[model samples]
Target: MDNLLDFFKAYDISLSQMIIVAIIFFVTIAMELSIRLFFRRYEKATQHSHTIKILFYLSLNKPLQLATMVIGFYFMAMHVLTWFRFTSFFDQVVTPGVELGLALCFFVLMNTFLSRLKTYSITKKTRTDGGYNNFAKIEQIHKLGQALTIAVMVFVIAAILGLKVAQGVAYLGGGLAIIALVFKDTISSVFGGLIIYLDSPYAVGDWIYTIDGTIQGTVEKISWRLTHIRTFDKRLIFTPNNLLITQAVVNASRMSNRRILQYIGLRYDDFDKFEAIQKDIYTYLGEHPDIDQNCLTLVNVVNGSTDMGSTTEGFFGGSSLNFQVYTFTKVTNWLKFQAIQDKIMMDIGRIIYRHDAEIAFTTMTLDISSEGAEPSPQAT
Candidate 1:
């Protein structure tokens, strides 16, 4: 050790400074390894927990390692420069650089911490009952938190660089004004997204349609400027958020039940069976498991004549007797509702057959009098 110090001393390098640097380097590596091992154990222990899974996804190991290295480098530089008698150089360049690096490390740590916290909040909320009902509000808060984190980071960086916060904000405000002017539509879309986030009209995975019937699809994602929709035909659409704000959208996924409306007609010959069949159909719907009995259900005869300007009772030009059936099904899923409706219709057909009644169809009957006197001869 004495010979090694003598060799470095001849080159004006202090062996003690070199030893300090070596210690810092090894200590930094040790800290990094310790953090890595700790996180690995934590991940294994909490693997089954979703909250822990999210935390693992947003782990602080990387930032913590970076910060440890930065701190170690700062100390090593300070010791080496002091031993070299470069006090002015250390004060002017090294000190400020170290401060800047430390500030940046702090910013990164804060950003990561904020992100982790926000993600945890959202994940926790999603696991609760009726969580979807407040998802939009939580999402909005998350976005706001991110923006604030970025703003605070910028302020800290500026302060480290000896910039006044008020001056920096003023410059930022002016720059933003110009940017807003240059990108008015984009800004509008951003505001539109904010409105959507706050209003909670429709959310991700909702089946929605425009009132004009032009756009109908399931919402896949909602970003700052656009909303992604997957159409029923398997096409993806990127629609501007502002456009959605201007239009009326129907959220089909929010419907409590699906409606079933039909008009059933019976042949006039089966008039005697009409009253019993109608009553039976109503009773079936009221008692069906798939039907929502709380909603409006109706099975009533058409009281007016089918012909225009006629006042006949349940007679459509004496061809058939018609009745309307209106009801609601408990299921709102498209495929499930269709299946239920099909079963109900088939059951109604069976009921009609059991009552000895036939569904009506258009038919014609003709009679010719002898006044024409043009009877064809028998086959000759």
Candidate 2:
């Protein structure tokens, strides 16, 4: 050690300066090794914390490296300036540069930490509660958290650089109009996203139908600007948030009960048994386990209503009879709802057969007279 000190002294370097350099070098190496060992043990002990581990390593490594380099550079400059010709440039320019680097490193570290914490909290909540797994809500929270972090980091960095906050605010105010004009759509989308997060018209995994019939699908994800949907045909659609805000969305998955409204027509010959058929169908629907008992279930013959008999006045002279079947299923699942509907339809067909009724169809009869004879009116 003495020999090394003497050798540096020959080059006009102080023993204390050389000692500090060596200490910093060895300390950096030790820190690197310590970091590796700790991470290895931590990963082995808690593999479930893989996300946290990856975040920690990502947020830690670069900042530490940059900090080490900045410190070394600062001390080296100070020591070298003491021996050589010194100038105020080191104190004025170089010192501020080092401080800026350190401040940047700190900002990066904190930003990364906040991002990781946001992710970790979201993941933890998802594991605890199914509702917390709402992708739209979680995505909104993450975006807000990241925006706040960036804003804070900006202020902190400005302070470190000795820039006046008031001046920056004034400049921002001056440019507000231009910024607003340039990002009008983005601003609208951000507010739209906020509204969606708060109102929660639908969540991820929900089956949605737009009132305009332009979109119908399952919501797969919701980001800041767009909502992603997967259609039944396996096609993907990305809808802007602003458009969702303005349009009416029907959340099929959110319905408490699915309704089946049907009209069955029978031939005029079976009109006598129509009443019994309606009663039987109503009884079947009432006894169905999957049918919602609380909701209205109606099975009625159509004849004298203003629109029913009035519309049939021109055709068949109101002789046709139609039965209306209306009921709500207890389940909201699409596939199960379809199955229930199929079963109910089959049951109705069987009931009609048992009642000795035949299904109705539009028909017309024509009469042919010898070529020159007067044509008779058609019967429909």
Which candidate ranks first by lDDT, i.e. highest?
Answer: 1
User: Judged by lDDT against the true structure, how good is candidate 2?
Assistant: 0.75
RMSD of 1: 5.6
Q: Give me the displacement of residue 38 in model 2, in angstroms.
A: 6.4
lDDT for 171 (candidate 1): 92
TM-score of each model, paired residue for residue: 0.74, 0.62
What candidate 2 gets wrong by more than 4 Å, as runs, is 1-140, 266-272, 302-321, 353-380
- Give a tens-digit lDDT track for model 2, residues 295-319: 9998875444425433643212344
Q: lDDT for each of the candidates?
A: 0.78, 0.75
Candidate 1 local lDDT, 227-345, one digit each (tens): 99999999999989999999999988778788998777789889788889988998999899988888999988766754322334464545667787889987777778888899999
Each candidate structure's count of clashing pairs: 0, 0
